[model samples]
Target: MKKENNTNKKAVCIMSGGMDSTLSAYMMKNQGYEVIAVHFNYDQRTQAKELACFENICESLHVKQKYILDLDFFKQLGASALTDTNIEVPTGGVEEGVPVTYVPFRNGIFLSMAAAIAEKEGAEVISIGVVEEDSSGYPDCREEYIQAMQKAINLGTKDDTKIEIKMPLVHLKKSQIVQEALHLDVPLELTWSCYKNEDKACGVCDSCRLRLNGFKKAGVNDPIPYA
Candidate 1:
C-alpha cells in the first residue's frame, strides 16, 4: 500500500505479540516511523492467543499495514517444543545452553520474510525484539548474528533498496525492556509470552517466568493474568 501523500519514515516490524516484539513495534512508532507490522503464525503452541494479541497490539499502535503470514512448515519440521507437541516446553528454569523452546532459525526465516515485505512496501527498516543479555541462551539472539543477517539481506535485495535491521532490545535485559516499554507507554497487557497456555499465562513457563521477573525487577505489576 503506497502512501503517496505520507512522507514519514517507514519500518516493517516483526511482531510476535510478545512483550519484546510488541515493545519494538511501539518503539518504531515512537521514533516517527509509519510502522508496518508483520506477524507469523508458525504453527506454534499458542498461535491463536499470539494472533489475538498481535491484532490488539496493532490496534494500540494504530498500525495500518500488517502482514499476518502462515508458515506451516515449522510444524512439519517438529524440532522445537513450541512447534512440536511431543517435545515438552521446559518450565523448570532458563537452563544453560540453548533451550528446547528455541525455534530452529526462526528469526532468520522471519527476517527473510520481513526483508521481502520491506522491499515490497518500500520500507527502509526492519525491526525485531531479540534480547541477548538475560535471555534464555538462544544463540540466534546474538547481536552479531542479527548484523550478519542484515548484511545478507542488503546483499540479496536490489542495489538501491537499502534496509537496516534494527534490534533495539538486543542488548537490553528483560528489566530494561520493561522500563523502556513503560516509558514508551507500550500496551504490555496486550502482549502474550506464555509458551503453553492460551486462556491464562502459565506463570511457570520459561517465557512467563522471564516476563514476571522483568516486571518484578522493574517494580511494576504485570497487567496480564497468570495461572
Candidate 2:
C-alpha cells in the first residue's frame, strides 16, 4: 500500500484478528490512511475468539468505522477443517500442496466482499494479511493470484471505482512478520491464530506451530496462552 501525506485516503482492511492482519492495519494507519476495519464470521472453529480479538484490536487501533460481517454460507459449503466439523484440523504440521485447512477460494470470497465494501466506502485500497512464502499452503494467498484478483476486481467494479488489493505480508516469512508487528507496536496479545480451541490455543495446530515458530525465530515470547 502506498503511503499518503494526507489522511483523506481510506483503506478497507480485512482483519482476521491475527498477528499479520493486525500488523497490516497498523501499517495502513501509520501510512496516514483512514482505516475501515472488516471482519468475517465464517463459522470457523475459532469464530468467537477471532471475533472478540477483532473487536479488541479495532478498539486499540481507534478505528471508528468497522464491519463485522457474518458469512454463514462458508459453513454450509464446508470442505476445509476450519469451517467443517467433519474434517479435523491437522495438528501434525503444515503440509505440502493445498491442505484441508485451505477453504476453497476463501481469500477470493473475502476480497470480493472487501471490494464491494471498498467501492461503497469510496476507499482507494483494501488490505489483507495473506502470507504466501511462510504459510499454510493456500493457493489463494499467492501474490500472483492476488494480483489477478486485483485485476478482476477492477474490471468488475464501477468504471470510476478503482481499488487496489494490498497484501503486505505476502512475501514475508513468519519471523519477519513478527519482527514487523513488534516494530509497529501491534497488540500481539489481542490476536488469535489457533485453528482449534478458542480459550487456550491448541499449541500443536498448524497455526499455533507457525506462530510459535515465528516468535521463537524472532527471539520473543508469544504473549498468547497455549495448551
Candidate 3:
C-alpha cells in the first residue's frame, strides 16, 4: 500500500455497508489517511436499511465525512434485480449468465461519481472494495475494468494529477477479506450484505450466501443475524 503524504491528503472510499467495503475504509483510516465514505442510494428495496447501516458504520469509525448520493436515475434504467424489485435476487452463485443481482454498470457509475467528488475534495485516491474471488463472473469487479476506469479518471479529471484507484482486497478471497477485517478490529456487525430487507438475512441470496461461506471459510462466526 502506497502511503499518502500525511499533510492535506484525502481519500474517498466507496462504502456499501458490506464486509469488503467496510474493511477497506477501516484499513485506509488505519494508515493515517483522511477518509471520506461514499454510498449510493439506488432506491432498491433494501436501500433505506443499507443506508442506515452505512451511516452507523461511518459514524462509529469517525470518518472525516460521508456522502450518500441518490441514484434514482440509474433505477429508471432498470436492468438489474437490485433496482427492479419485480425480479428476485438470485440464490447461490451457480446460475447461468451474470447473476440477476448484478447491477448494470453500477461500479462504473459509482466510481465515476467518486472520481468527480475526489477532484472537488482534492483527494488523490479513490478506494473501492472489490474482490475478485467473490465477484466470480461480475465483469465490473475485475482488475481489467478497474484499470480502465483509472485510465478514464486520469484523462477526465481536472487535476492533471492521476487519481489512484485502490483495491486492497482485489486479489484476496472473501474469506481472507473477513480475516483481515477481523484483524483490523472492524465492526462486522454494523455492515449489511443481505438482499432481503426482513428482520434477518435471507441467507440464500448470492450476497448472503457468499458472506456466510466466507465466514465459514475464515473460521469466524458471522456476527450478523441470518434467516
Candidate 4:
C-alpha cells in the first residue's frame, strides 16, 4: 500500500458506488487531501455489480488507493434487505417508518472499519456520504449518531491517535448534496445507487427516486441510465 506523505492531512472515504459516496470522495479529493476509497462486499446479491461500478469510478477518478473489504461477517448476522434477497427492496419514499432496506447498523460498522484503516494509515479523518434528508429515517444516519460515533472513535482509538468522522453532507438535503457535487464536477454518471442490479436504475426504488428527485431539484440531468 502506498501511503500518503502528508501525514496530518489524509482522509479515507467510504465509497459505495452511490452518488453520495462518490461525491464525498470527490469533495475530499478536491479539498487537496490524499483520499483513499474504502468499499465493502458483504455477500449481498448486488455486491458484484456494485463492486464493479466502484472499481470503475476509482480508476476513472484516479484515486490514489482503494480497498475492497470482505464483509461476509455481516452476512452471518443478516437482518436487512440489502443482505437478504428474500426481502424485496422498497420503492418510493419511506413515508410511514424506517424502510426494510435500512441495513443493520451499516453506516456505523462501515465508519468503524474506515476509522481503523485511517488510524493505521495515519489519517485524521474518515469521510462518509450519509445525508440527513435521504437517510433521515435511518437512525444510524442521524446527526446524533455521527457525533456519538466520532466520540467513540476518538476514545477507542486513543492509543492509536485521534480520528474524526466527517459527515460533510449529513445536515444537507439530497438536492443540496447534488448541487455541491455538481459544483465539484463529480462524475455522477459513474455512481450506482439503484437497489436492483440491472443495466439501468429501477427508477422506483427509494434510492433511485431520491437520486432522480435530487438531480431534478438541482436542475441537472442525472447522467446515469434510469429505467
**Among all candidates shown, the one with the greatest lDDT:** 2
Which lDDT tens digits does candidate 3 get at residues 1-227? 44445766778999988888999988887776788889999877688778888999989778767898997886898888888888877775657767777788889999999998998888888999998766646779898899999999999877566699999999998789888988888999999888876468888887887888899999989998987
lDDT of 1 by residue, 139-200 (tens): 88999999999999999999999999999999898999999999888888899999999999
lDDT of each: 0.92, 0.93, 0.85, 0.82
Task: Estimate, for each residue in 1-227, the C-alpha lDDT of model 4 and write its tens digit.
Answer: 22234544888999988888888777777666788889999877568778988998898778777899998877787677778887888775665787777788888899999988998888888999888866638888887899999998988886759887888888787888888887877777878888876587888877888888888998888898877
Residue-level lDDT of model 2, residues 16-125, one tens digit each, is: 98999999999999889899999999999999999999999999989989999998899999999999999998888778778899888889999999999999999999
> Candidate 3: where is the Cα deviation over 4 Å?
1-5
| Selected candidate, larger TM-score, 1 vs 3 | 1
- Give the worst 10-residue stretch by lDDT in candidate 4: 1-10
Ordering by lDDT: 2, 1, 3, 4
Candidate 2: regions farther than 4 A off: 1-4
Instruction: Give candidate 1 misplaced runs (Cα > 4 Å).
Output: 1-6
TM-score of structure candidate 4: 0.91
Tally clashing residue pairs in candidate 4.
Answer: 0
The residue pairs found clashing in candidate 2 are: none
